[model samples]
Each structure stands twice: as C-alpha cells, then as structure tokens.
Target: MDGEYHPKSEATVSVYDHGFLYGDGVFEGIRAYNGTVFRLKEHIRRLYEGIKVTRINLQLTKEQMTNAIVDTLRKNNLTDAYIRVIVSRGRGNLGLDPRSCPKPSVVIMAEPVAPAHGKEAREKGITAIISGYRRDRVDGTSHELKSLN
Candidate 1:
C-alpha cells in the first residue's frame, strides 16, 4: 500500500504488476451497512488466508490492514458503501515468474452502489445459463483465492 489517499481518477497501478501480468493476487468485496462494516474480521481473515495460500509477503499485519480500511473510509467520509480491497503482486520485470516480484500492492476503494438487479427479479427468479468452461479445482488452483485477472 502506498499510504496516501488518492482520488479514484488519480489512483494508478504500474503496468509491470504481476497481478496484471499473471493474475497473481487476491481480493475481497466488503459492504458497510448502517454505519458498520459488515463482517470485517471475516473479510480480513479470508484475505490473509488468500495471501498465505499465494505466498505473498504482505508487509502489513492483518490488524493494520483492517485499520487501513477504516482510515480510508474516514478519509473519504463515507458510510453505507461498498468497499473493494485488492492486493496484487507488485511490479516486476516482464516475465511470467513471480519470483521477480519482491512485494505486493494493496488498494482499497469505497463507493456507493445501488442494487443492479430489480426486486422483481429476486421474486420472479432470473434465467440461468450453463457454460462448458469450468473453474479450476481447488487442488489445482484455489477458487477461494480471488485473482485480479
């Protein structure tokens, strides 16, 4: 994390990031409701679990990350919002190998969002389509770990 607040338009990540190159990263989607961050600890725990699985050496402790989330919210003067926390493999030379990356980049964004689907859809049910492609199994590639790509 850069430790500075930037406007959404000004926030930028390096093109050399391994996350952008090879999708080496993890993320969590969080919500703030009624002035409280819903399931904050659970979200942090899941994020750490992903980091452990990906073997990304995040310099900040879990508690610090949690505080950072709060700080970001305070800086933005927001409540009742959606928060996206992303930790991506840091910048490195152009190569598929992650060993070239020495750090991880963290970004947290908060914004207001209304429901995308209508209430009638929930009540009447929505159509579904099945695809031939399937996700990689947990043993092969953990679905629990969220990748930016």
Candidate 2:
C-alpha cells in the first residue's frame, strides 16, 4: 500500500513491483525502546543513504519520513517494538529497467517482538567469532554506500 495504513492482512504490493520482481529496493530494521525510537536520526540517515545509492526518488523527505514513523507508532500505540521501513520501486514491466518504474512505494511496519533469548539464555550467554567472509567485492556489486563510522 502506498502511504496509507492498512491492516497486516490487507497490506499488499503489486506483483509487478520491481522490488518484488527483481529485488530492486532497500530497507532498514529499527527498534524502539520505551517511548523513544532509538537512534532514529541515524536510522533515517542510513536509510537515505540507501535510497541515494539505489537512486530511488522518494516522494517524502527525511523529516517527513521521520514524522511518518512517529505517527505510525502513535497510531499503533506502540512504545517498544521492532520496526521495518521498506522502500520498493513501484510497479513496472517484466524488464529489469528502472525506468519501467516511475514512483517508489514505502511501507512501515512495526510489531512487538520479544528478545531473541530469554533472561536465562542471556545469563548463560554465548560465544562467537566474526566471519571471515566478505559479502561484497570492492570492484563489483559492493553494498557499501557510505563510509562506515
């Protein structure tokens, strides 16, 4: 759905949407703690960076998007939850051409999510090591859009 809020069961995007058709889009996962959206500005900034690198001409500015998120949380009466902001290239033909899609679509979804592990698990803790695998090729389709801070 474009800019309107809809029930989860009613929310949908066209099959021809480039985002669905060819993975032509980007998104961000954010969280809210208590009554505040955590690192909201940073999330918006990073989201915009993705939008910039993907060349998606969003109809709303960063301020508007932030307002939208806050409004959504208010409407949902959610203070603590997981949030997802998804921007997809709108409907298009079968081809992989960006021009096929004129406008982009945005969807913001929020839901209460429990911690991945309970207090017992947290107390037990776990150990891990960083993966040596690199997800991108510097000379190829690297996902780096902005310099890491």
Candidate 3:
C-alpha cells in the first residue's frame, strides 16, 4: 500500500497498521471528469490538514500527492472515475500508542463507478434518511479532520 499500484486482488496491508488496528489514518474521496480531476488541490489541502490534526508525518508533499493521484488515473486508463486516497499510520506494535509507528503508508486507487440511484433519481429526486448520530468533538478525532476512524 506504500505508493505501489496493484490489482484489487493483490493489494494488501499489514494487520499491524494503526489505520487497520486503530483507525489511525485519513482519506479523501475524489472524482475525475473528462480526464480532469475535480478540485484536486482542495482535496490535497484537506488531506494535509487531516494529517496535521492526527500528527502523522506523511512523507509526500502536497504537489507530490497530487501528481500521484493523476498518475494513478493515467495508469488505470481512467478518464471518468472515483479516486480514493488513504494515508495510514504504518505498522506498529499492538499497543494503542501511535508513537510506536514510525512511518505512514500511502495508497491511491481509481476505479469507474455508476451512480448508485441511476439516472431516474437525478431526474426525479428520491427520498432519503439522515443519520441521527453525530461524530464526537475530540481534537484528534474530530469529524472535520476526516480519518480512518
């Protein structure tokens, strides 16, 4: 998961990853339209902000991350697609403390997806339900930060 592109079948991550073990990570959902990534800069900014909130030292800069996303799309030959970027606290011991994790893992995946509700929903809006639960207001776990949690 560390900057390498792999088929969905082959991609894997360590069980010790803080993200997997403790939801210690951040991610951004992005979209590409007509070969152009939409609001990529803004997404990158949000990602960095999340990293800041979580105190994760992502090795890549904002520019590098942006290039990686574009590169992933190009590699997959995807013009219009859904892209998800995840940066996770790397492998560590079973302990809950994050300091045991020395590095972070980065992953960029792109795939095509159709609208869940189909075109009819776009033409005539469908009914919906909203969750009553709200995220807690803790500093490291704030909903605004966007994390694996």
Clashes of each: 0, 0, 0
Q: How well does each candidate superpose onto the true structure, as a TM-score?
A: 0.79, 0.79, 0.81
Residue 62 in model 3: shift from native, Å?
0.5
lDDT at position 17, candidate 2: 86
lDDT of 2 by residue, 1-149 (tens): 46799988988888998888888887878899776999999989888988888888888999999998988888889988899888887788999889989999888999876666778878998777999998777787544343111
TM-score of 1: 0.79
Alpha-carbon shift of residue 140 in model 1 (angstroms): 8.9
- Model 1 residue runs over 4 Å out of place are 114-143
The worst-scoring run of ten residues by lDDT in candidate 3 lies at 135-144
Models ranked on TM-score: 3, 2, 1
Best by lDDT: 3
- Clashing residue pairs in candidate 3 are none
Weakest lDDT window of 10 consecutive positions for candidate 2: 140-149
Give lDDT for model 1: 0.85
lDDT of 2 at 97: 86
Give the C-alpha miss distance for residue 118 in model 2, angstroms: 6.8
> What is each predicted model's overall lDDT from 0 to 1?
0.85, 0.82, 0.88
